[model samples]
Structures are given as structure tokens and as C-alpha cells.
Target: MTTMLGVLLRVYLVLGFALEVQTFVRLYVLSTPIAALTPSLSDPALDNVPAFRRLYAVYCISLGLLRLAAAVDIKNKGLLAALAIVHVVEAAFSIAEVLVFQHVPPQALLDEPHLKTTGFLALLVAQALLFAYGYMTASTIKSKMHEW
Candidate 1:
């Protein structure tokens, strides 16, 4: 069980890190306009977006740390519960972002929206699964504590 939990944590950390990097490169190095990346939100001043990005970066960093900590503290029900809550929140946010915002017109709208929406939905499902697994892990840990 510990091994499985560790694997899940590492997977999420890797994925989250990749996304953070991709978003940064797309927004800055690639010279892709911010509107292209964040089509859902009304076009905002570059300055405002930067702050949000920075905060998001920080959150991702924390997520990585939390995953590592969860692996170490696998027996801690409280920690697992907290992590599950966070995952659910993230999933909800991703779903809402896709549904509420019109992505900048992709040259190939069907292909892009189809792919993006599918990917986002997949992420949401994955996150929900992880959250459920985490909650179960937490309950197991809690029950084991009573046994001890």
C-alpha cells in the first residue's frame, strides 16, 4: 500500500511539474500570447497574470512537497484526508476552467477543443480517483491505529 501511494504521489508531482513548465514556456519563451493559453479568463494585463502564474507555481511546488510528505506519513489519516481534499479542488477548478471559458480560436477548432476537453475531463476523473484512493488509504490508516 505504501508503495502504491508513493507511486501515485510521484506521478502527480511529475505531471504537475510538467504542466507548470509548459504553461511558463508557452506564456513566455514560445511567445504565445497569454490569450492563447488562458482563453477562459477575460484578457487581463500582463502584470496581473504574472502574479497569478507565480502563485500557481508556488502552489505546484507545495503540491509536490505535500505528495512527498504524504508518502512519508502514509499512516497519518489527517494528512491523507487533507491531500484528498486538495486533489478534488484541483479537479473541480480544471473542469470549470474548460467549461466556462472559450479557448482562443484554434485554427483547427474541432481537433483542439476535442483534445483539450477530453484531456481536461480525463484529468478530472483521474484526480477524483486519486482522491477516493487517498481517502480509503486514510481510513485504513485510521482503523489500523485503533488496532495498534
Candidate 2:
């Protein structure tokens, strides 16, 4: 079971890294085209904020690197725990964005593509599952260490 969990975690990490890198490229390198394609995804207030976009790109790339490292060394309990925390924090921020901050207007929500909303919900669930898996993997590793 532990081995299976580790394998799943590794796969998730690699996929996460790929996604982060893709987001970084889209946000930083292809911002204009991407924004044109998905105007609803872009906030008009942030249009003039190039620095914010660049900072976000940097953040995405950093997360990608961390995910890559975690995937390479799945047995590292500390890394697993750190990743778990990251996932939870991200999830919390996302929740706060939509719920607390009202980042997405209620009336405008109906005008957006259903696929986009579904995809965001799917990502949220995946983040939660990843957090659980990371915690389980780290706990398993700690137990095994004591068994030796």
C-alpha cells in the first residue's frame, strides 16, 4: 500500500510540475495571445500590472521546480510534508479568492464556460487529494524508519 501510494504521489508531482511550467509559459511568454483567447480569465484591473504577471510566472516556475525535486526524491519525508502544506495553502487561497474575496462576480459566473468552472473544481479536489497523499506518504515513511 505504501509503495503504491508513493508511486501515485510521484506521478502526481510530475504532472503538477508539468502543469505549473505550462502555466508559467502561458502567463509570461504567451500572455497576450492567451489573454485574447481567454479574456474571462484575465482581470481588467491586472491588465496594466506587468509586474504582477511576471511575479506570478516566477512563482509558478518555482513551484514547478519544487514539484520536480519532490518527484525525484519521493522518500524524503520532509519534502513530502512541505508539499502537503503547500497544497493545502494553495487550496485555502483558491477558496478564499472565490468565496471571501468574490473574485468571480455572481452574475458573470453564469456567462462563463461550464468547462472552466468544472476544471477549477477538479483542480481543487486534486489539490486536496494530493495533500492527503503527501501526508500519508510521509507518515508511512516515518513508521518504516522506526521499524528498522
Candidate 3:
């Protein structure tokens, strides 16, 4: 008898894990071609740095693993809370990178040929929504309770 929140959280966690793993693969294994194809979407300073790309890939994979763990143990409140916080941080960093850090101009974000920036921003928004949903779901879980 899993609640709707539990089901949603599980789905979100699984999706997040898949996306993170995909990001790791793209960033590490296909960095060169991706960078060449989308120079404007890449960071010029770290684009050619293999070490940085690998480090980022590791980070992405680690996050994916965390999401996978949380998805498996969906009744763990602590893990859900941590994942919510992680999602918040990820969304915040992405927003900062685009707005505060000026990685991409605010006005030019949606002006790209293929809507890359638009997709990036939309993903961030989705992550933010996931964070809220995760937090709510976590709060609904009781300590020492295993079943959702």
C-alpha cells in the first residue's frame, strides 16, 4: 500500500539516477565531441581539461548511485531528505551558473538554435519541483518505519 508520494519519490529517484548516469557518460566518454558540437553550452575554461571532466563525471556517478540507493530504500526518511537537499543544491548551482555566474546570458538562454539552454533551465526547474516533493515525502515517513 504505497502512498502516492512514495510512488512519485521512487519514480523521481530512478529518473534522477538515470539522468545522472547519462550525464556522467556524456561528460566523461563523449566530452570531446559534445564540446565540439555545443561550444556555447560548454565551459571554455574546463572544456579541454580531462582531469576536470573526469572528476565531474565521478561526481555525477556518485550522485546517481545515491539516487539509486534512495530509490531502493524509498522508506528511508533520512535518505529522502538528503536527496531533497541534493536536488536543491543542484538546482541552485545551475541557476547560479546561468544567472549569477553568467555562464549564459539571461536574454540569450532561450535563443540557442536547438533550445539547449531552454532544456537546461527546464531540467533545473523539474529538479526544484522534485526537491519539494521529496522533502514532503520525507516528512511523511516515520522514524524506524520501513514500509511506505
Candidate 4:
């Protein structure tokens, strides 16, 4: 039976990957929903929606790919350890997002009233959980004498 932690980890990865891919698709492809995605909950003066949205898409895709790889090789201490580092770094960025930092701007439309409250909260929680899970899983895995 899969433990809750294991399920949570996979759920986090899959949701993260799906959301990123969805954002990328909506941003670069069809415009049905993208047209309505110009969320203005933040200070427009400091936010670069297009630029940050693109960067965010790239970040999501890359992180999702890495997380997928780690999930595939969860038993490898090396991979898990590396993923743990990545998760912490990503969590830092996510924290910046929560704080409304321009360095980590919100993805376009993701902060809209419709999805704003629940979605943003979920992202924050998921980031924290993933970071904790990553570190714990990495430390618990087998590793060489010098490996992390």
C-alpha cells in the first residue's frame, strides 16, 4: 500500500507538471482562456506579465521535468538529494511569489479572482510539502559514504 507521504509526493509532482504544461499551452498556444488571463491583482507598475509569465512557464517545465525524473528514481539517494535541493530552491522562489516579489512574479491569470484564493494557497502548501518530503526522502534513501 502506498503511504500518504508517497501519494502526496506523487500528487504534488503530477499537479505541478500538469499546471506548468497547461500554463505553457495557454500562453503560447490557444487564446480562448489566455485572453481572459490578464489578472491584475498586483501593482501593474512593477509586474511584467508577459516576461514573467514566460519565465514562469520555463521554470515550471524544467522543474516538472526534474521532479518527474526524481519520482522515477525515488530510491536513488543521489537523485532524491538533488531533487531536495531543487525543491528548496523552488520553494524559495515560491515564497517570493507569495510575498509579491517582482523577482518571482505571479504567472499570468493564475492570480485571477476565480482561481486566486484556492489556487495560490494550494501552490504555497504544495511547495512547502514538497520541500519537506524531498529532504526526508533523500535522507532516508541509501547512499555511498560520500554521497549526499
Give the candidate number with the greatest lDDT. 3
Off by over 4 Å in 3: 30-41, 103-107, 110-114, 139-148
Give TM-scores for every candidate, taking all chains together and pairing residue i with residue i: 0.58, 0.73, 0.72, 0.54
TM-score of predicted model 2? Answer: 0.73
Query: By TM-score, how accurate is candidate 4?
Result: 0.54
lDDT tens digits by residue: candidate 3, 1-148: 3366677777888998998888887777767544443233356777767786777688789989988998888876667677777767866766676666655566776685536756766776776676666656565644423564
- Clashing pairs in model 1? none
Candidate 2: lDDT over CA atoms? Answer: 0.68
Per TM-score, what order, best first?
2, 3, 1, 4
Better-scoring candidate (TM-score), 2 or 3: 2
Tens digit per residue, CA lDDT, model 1, 36-99: 6543433456436767666654675576666556555655656667777887887777556655
Assess each prediction's global lDDT (C-alpha) against the native: 0.59, 0.68, 0.69, 0.54
Error of 1 at 133 (Å): 2.3
Q: Which sequence of candidate numbers ranks them by lDDT, best first?
A: 3, 2, 1, 4
Which ten residues in a row are the worst by lDDT in model 1?
Answer: 139-148
- Could you tell me the TM-score of candidate 3? 0.72
Candidate 4 Cα misplacement greater than 4 A, ranges = 1-4, 31-51, 78-87, 94-122, 139-148
Task: For residue 70, give model 2's deviation from the true position in Å.
Answer: 0.6
In model 2, what lDDT does residue 139 have? Answer: 63
Quality of model 3 by C-alpha lDDT: 0.69
Error of 4 at 72 (Å): 1.3
Q: Which residue pairs overlap in candidate 3's backbone?
A: none
